[model samples]
Target: MNYKDPSLPTAARVDDLVARMTLREKAGLLFHTIWFAPPPGAETAESMIDGRHMNHFNVLGGGSPREMAEWHNALQERAAATRLGIPVTFSTDPRHSFSSNPGASMMAGAFSQWPEPPGLAAIGSAELVRKFADIARREYVAVGIRVALHPQIDLVTEPRWSRANGTFGQDAELTSRLVRAYILGFQGERLGPGGVACMTKHFPGGGPQKDGEDPHFAHGREQVYPGGRFEHHLKPFEAAFDAGTSQIMPYYGMPVGTEHEEVGFGFNKGVITGLLRERYSFDGIVCTDWGLITDAFIMGQEMPARAWGVEHLTPAERMLKAIEAGVDQFGGEACPDLLVELVEDGRISTARLDESVRRVLREKFTLGLFDAPFVDPDAAEEVVGRADFARAGFEAQTASLTLLKNGPLPLADGARVYVEGVDADVAAGYGKVVATPEEADVAVVRLAAPYEHRPGAFEAFFHSGSLAFPAAEIDRITRLQATVPTVVDVYLERPAVFPEIAEGAVAVVADYGASDRALLDVLFGRAEPQGRLPYELPRSMAAVEASPSDVPGGTADPLYPFGHGLTS
Candidate 1:
């Protein structure tokens, strides 16, 4: 049991643990499947930990802070009594955002809520990014979650890309700076039992998808760089490696017309091995993006395996290709049986399996899981979502407001305010609440920019397609402006076509994602609009259509350029 001793070197401990594990035990280490943290009656902690023999899991659908903490402690206690007593490592998607795409990320429930990643970039402060990450780290560790499946370093070059809200804007240099601070905050100077190790994701960048479609579906599988700027996307990832990220996830998009193989990054040896492993010398765990070997059921709908170019291959063949491509783990998959069969059939050597097992074991030891794995449920309740943490997040929410039009902003006190898309109960404190725009002295209207609706339950969560506002909606807003001197606050998740609204309204304010209270604070002179535009707003849909997919900034004249903000 020398591996159980904390005094031993991590390498020595990893070597001992891997040497003693059975083929099934080793195979379990290579798969990280999704597990609902809330225990929805179908799956229990025993089935996931002991029956499946899984040590690593990507947790989904969490509950209140205390409820999550108690569940984590109970789960950890169960693992501690099992044979060899290996601790579980729970990973999660970004959980502090307003965007509630179940497939992409979680909503901020009981956790402190802030604007999305683009909002952080809009503020353009590396120190602030670090502080937010550190706060997130504390909240995560409080609930026994030790892995962050985030700090998505993908550049937001393509305006129509659905995942751009998760990125640090389109500038490579700025993304790099923030990426470094983010890693440092989560993992600290060195990882330990208490730290939440960051998994920097969608390696070599996921931007520049053809026509801004995601690679999660068949129609959106191809990623092309028509502007010959493929290398431009990789700058942030290079910085991520320099900052010493614990894990990496390759995107599912297959490169088209590039020097590397025309296959998904998980299945592409040139990209995964030549570029990432050999050229970059990254020795960390490389977990392939979810569902490469099997079809996945997300939110009650079955979707095809994101095998892309390797779809013609069998499930077993796809898994083998991923192993050959130098990936150490399979995400969102639980078929350790296939890996065991592949070894027995001589398709893959046991030595290859051992390579991955060693890396997996090393991470567990580096995390100090073997020495001290269980957490205090009582302590978890006290630390998560405390008053001070919520204050910082609210302040960040206020700081992220971008004032596109400053005319009549920081509105004078005691005016009758008519609000839309904001709670009337909340707005009543600032000014007299009116029933209609006509009754009000000034109208404050908030609207989320339109996106072309996609089919299916899961796809709807991801806001994709056109960034243009419909003609009918535009006409309604302009008509309202004509009737009253309106202040238009638009949630710019995808940079909406809003030139008409910008020109018609008395004032225009752009927000990535902000609560009603935060918006009111900026409007009523309680706080300043510190955020600038992280990405450009296209002048028209024609300009967006003509723009290169890989380049930063707009192709034609932008209605509002990057870093556009006004002070009162």
Candidate 2:
């Protein structure tokens, strides 16, 4: 139990301590929760509110810096109270930006709001990406977040996946290089002291999800590797491993009918152990995608537990299977008790527990948590949301703006321009803007497709797998185009192809997360359009419908192909 003994090498010391750990303590390391503090006066009351506890799965509702720090300290204290004093390594979803499932969104109030990964990639500077990671590391370290569950390196090949905002873009080569830089920035040269471990995710690239739906739901759980080009997905991950990523997370989808494993990657022995460990020689910890061990609840509605091709297995059975298959930890998992129960039942061997525990301990030791367990509370404000950070975000936003067209008319400086769709304040900085589309010489209509909200029925909205746009809004844009030489800017997160507007407008531009200044800069020819379309813009829902939900290949006729960008 003397983990601190210098006589033994670090790994061996970890192994020795791990060998002495009880199954419960080992399992505890595997499960992490997003720790948030209770509301102002809620702690003293006997009855608990819904969002009071440390949920472990999603955002901790919301918390102030002091509250967050206090909660993290308490959680670490609890971990220290355990037999081995294995400090709980807390993790977070991207706390920096507004993208993908904001129910899990952490406020960027304290942290810098870097442009999402697409914009960062469009900036196309490896150094900037690294710098972004470094800044994030400082902020995360301040908040006691040991693991940054991000730098999602999935190629943005599939346009329909709701989570594509997190990816770099479609080019495998670009994504590969950036992933390495990003990993280096977040993890540093070594794990210990002032560095936050990066968990590079959705291994073998999660971009090719069938029909662009996330695998979190049962209907979207199948992944197709048609043409056997599945190896293409492995490139960035290979780069990540080479760059020394501390951890990897397998995505939710399974390669159902492919040459790869039949079960979900997390539980697939061939994928996690046979390929990742044995073939690739990856020694880092493998974490399961969020909620892989239990039944999923979408918007408070409990759906039937999906085993992802392993239909006969229960949640407990799947936990044992994943651990035996080679996953070292569970991302956002709720059931550590199940892992303990499996060990007690001899379903998972003590040797396997020791193997995983040693890996986890190695990471902690590499991070130098033993030497400096607490972060400086005073440094929190100084490190987060600095002026330079906003400037970087603005620069990235500028670079990401893609100009898709030019007409007989070019934007003249001091021209009366109108903007619609986005917030009025966000649009006003563009030019002599107006409240209505008809008031100006030119109209710039910005549009983003609606996302699913919780109050809406989950099965009808998400699980059934359909995308719809409001007809009224579509009509309004079409009507405005009749009066002026309008330019349409579609933030195509889910590829809402406005055919009516596409035909009516003089020009069209598609981008991810372009700010007001960037949008106007491109409009006024202050900046050239250098960004290429990361994914093929679908012509219609029918085009998407024609393609197999499983296989996403063999399409040349898109509204706009990948790499297509028209400069003004």
Candidate 3:
């Protein structure tokens, strides 16, 4: 009855809910899984709201704000029909960024799109990062998304790491400052019921991956610290802790040669219980990175469980170990039956299950989900991706462009231009669009940070491996540059190597995630590239290989060092 009362304190409400929940219901609170959006025809029990009693979810795909809100209301209506009526907590990865890697961040659909975190880092303003978070939070809340699986504050110490675009940058102090601002913008001075809760991720930092290989794959499981700067990576999480971030998700990478066990951070008791819980005093809910307990087929590929050191254990055993390791919930896992089995067999105590359930219920109650569980579908359309938010995003895209090389000043007004990899119609707004570089006074080309091609549908999205531009690609760019004074804008998703292109191009600029209009505005001097290099651009793959994974600013004589920028 107290849980049903809106006037009661969150703790009291949580206590009431915990006392009444059955063992199966308590077990259900420990698993959070990928939520399937509504099918074209009839909907089924994919969410386990009735069959498994699971309530927490991570929404994968994008949708219009109105449709998302309507789906949420329908989903919450199902929860209301349940015995206990515990409202669902919908969470999502970064949807405001340009990165479309489904494994990392979702690309925007109807949501306002902005530059990636590194672009915010390029601008290097805590205030702007906070503003971005605030706008993103409002957009998320409007569509009934209560949890943010982001503000991924991992320090980008490893330049070749595929996940660099999701992080702030390599500098620990700078990242720490931004992390604090980001959490504040999302959760605010208090974890206000009106605000969205942040799940700051890849705890203790996920950036120092061995050989720059992502831990998402089996072959790339080691998180090495050859530079002996393991403590350096924890600075941002410490800042997150200080900022009162509501949740934590440990990374999937296993520690290679650290004092702790050589297991993934999600399954490491030393890291989670001893380090995060005891030393740092982080009492927030700790969820494991996705798919750590079970293996399944995803994106037409055989996805293996990221059990790391405990791959030898059965699924039930891995769940038990993670529970003992101080994890509150399993991310991207839905098998609450396994949890019930563990508790029924006396392998996991009821007290342990209740402990996690208490955290879960407290968050739901504190968020006011128990009091107001549904959203207005009509209100969502007007609030999300509104004009002001879109304008701010466009401005950020323009501001984040880092001028790495100085060439000719703003293109001669109405001068002829030849373009590649850009919208010709957008180019026509500023200058005469010519078909050939030979006929133009200047040429513009867009290049993406190069990656080794993988065949898998999902794996290919991850831009891992060597950060060098292929020789053939370089030759083509060189040939283009010789014909006219050319300007190159490379998408610096990961720090890319393109010395030949850099040498030949009249001007070189880097953008994390810029729109065509944003790039053109900067090209025409309508806006200044008010950004500096967030990470150093290596001169070649040789320098990238020579640098230690854990050390920041260690690339040997990088073509463009950190903080390198120019303005005409």
TM-score of 2: 0.87
Q: For residues 384-427, write the lDDT of model 3, one tens digit per residue.
A: 99999999999999999999997795777698999998999999
TM-score of candidate 3 versus the correct structure, residues matched by position: 0.99
lDDT over C-alpha atoms for residue 360 of model 2: 80
Using lDDT as the yardstick, the better of models 1 and 3 is: 3
- Candidate 2 has its poorest 10 consecutive residues by lDDT at 45-54
Candidate 2 stretches with Cα past 4 Å from truth are: 5-9, 34-67, 81-83, 100-107, 296-298, 303-306, 408-414, 426-430, 449-473, 524-529, 546-554
* C-alpha local distance difference test of each model: 0.86, 0.68, 0.89
Model 2 global lDDT (CA atoms, 0 to 1): 0.68
Candidate 2 lDDT over 1-568, as tens digits, reads 4576655668777867776766665676676543334523434211111212121222354455555666666655554554465555667778776454432235466567656777666657788789888878877787677787877887655556676677877677878888888888888877766787888888867777776666767767878754466778788888888889988888878886676777888888888888889999998889877667666565667755446877678888888788878998876565677877888998888887877777887888777665456655566555566678767666666676666666833477766677766565655555676756567888877877544442345543432233445578678777888988898887755445556767888988776766666777777777776666655666676776665432333344776666677666
Off by over 4 Å in 3: 38-43
lDDT of 1 by residue, 68-184 (tens): 877776777777877878888889999987888866788888788888888898888999989989989999998888999988988777788888888888889989999999998
RMSD of each: 1.3, 4.0, 1.1
lDDT of 1: 0.86
